[model samples]
Target: MSPVIQEPAGIFITLEGGEGSGKTTQARRLCDWLTAQGRHVLHTREPGGTLLAERLRSLLLDRSAETIAPETEAWLILAARRQHVDHVIKPALQQGMIVVCDRFSDSTMAYQGYGRGLDLRTLRTMNKWATGKLAPHLTLLFDVPVRLGLSRRRGQRSSQNRLDREATQFHEKVRAGFQTLAKQEPRRMVVLDASLPLESVQRNVTTVITRWLNARRRQPRQR
Candidate 1:
């Protein structure tokens, strides 16, 4: 008997936002909607989607894990990203599954590059090397005020992740970082008002994604 093999011909979508911006909520909603539409969607989150990545996520999030240098944190994230892309994302995509990731390279740029004051040039190089040639077809950025997101995150019952436990200034920097990215890449990035009602936000996001998918479907097949 021979093992089965599957090839993926699907799209990659990433959801990004600062803490309490409702990214997780929206990501789940988007996944459910896509599945209902008969798409094979693989929903995952960054820093811990795979076995190796999950272990790193634990260390990265533990508040008492000792102070992690900015450059070191950046390297750890990129390392997880490289392994995650090679093992999980690439394989799922090859299986013809739409991959909806909760967070991707943008988080590293926002959290590490801007928030932690790491060099953006280095972050870009790491991202490019980690991802190889694949890029998300669409990125939904749930934009919210820094204060509002911090308040919401603080309200969560679970102790904040190490990153989340950072001072409010850090989170504000992250919010600004994401805003900058959205402005820089308006075409591939959709900025949604996350403060809006969840239902309304979800509907707007769905409409935009559906339209993009339709447009892609209309394109002529390449030889």
Candidate 2:
């Protein structure tokens, strides 16, 4: 099946990974690099792009006094996604900007579905409805060992979220889930060895994106 395009002229790229995989840093670097090349770029993150969505992000991430059920977590994430799509992502794409989102639908599939034992099929369907079938034009998945990623997160004690505190087994499941996804959609999702030095990863990211844009420029535009 063909992918959905929020806007024909815009490029939507997402950076995804488990905790402390360095996707956030890479995302910012991508935006900066694109801007230097004269591309109008919009950097945003899932669960926190719009005002309403940001509120939901806080609710989802903060150490809650109550346990958040897996289903409930999925519902809230999709709700935030709906707001993000309508208020932030779609509009930026409409203006013909490169939208650099830090996380997107795949996070839900990996974290809640695989890690928390929710059904992947159900989450995929829900994600489709929530985002109006919007999918990233390209997805860069930063991959690292769960122990390594969690160890990195542990070093950042001040910013630890509830997800960060999950058992190592949970993170391993999420990592495996992302791997399965990358293998399933090899064309769209590029997996990077995130354990590499920061400079090397950034170089690889820039090279990959430049190549993708050049290839797209050669292809006939789709209506």
| lDDT, each prediction | 0.87, 0.91
Q: What C-alpha RMSD separates each model from the true structure?
A: 4.4, 2.9
Per-residue error at 46 for model 1, in Å? 0.5
Q: Score residue 66 of candidate 2 by CA lDDT.
A: 82
List the candidate 1 regions with Cα displacement exceeding 4 Å: 1-8, 220-223
Model 2 — which ten-residue stretch has the worst lDDT? 214-223
TM-score of 2: 0.95
Question: What does candidate 1's lDDT look like per residue over 1-223, in tens digits?
Answer: 8986532477789999998899898889999999999999999989868899988888888888988998888888888888889998998888879899999999999999999898898889889998885678789999998888878888995867777777888888899899999999887788999998889999998998988888778872420
Q: Residue-wise lDDT of candidate 2 within 36-126, one digit each (tens)?
A: 9999999999878988899999999998648998999999999999999988888888889999999999999999988998988989999
Q: Quick one: best TM-score, which candidate?
A: 2
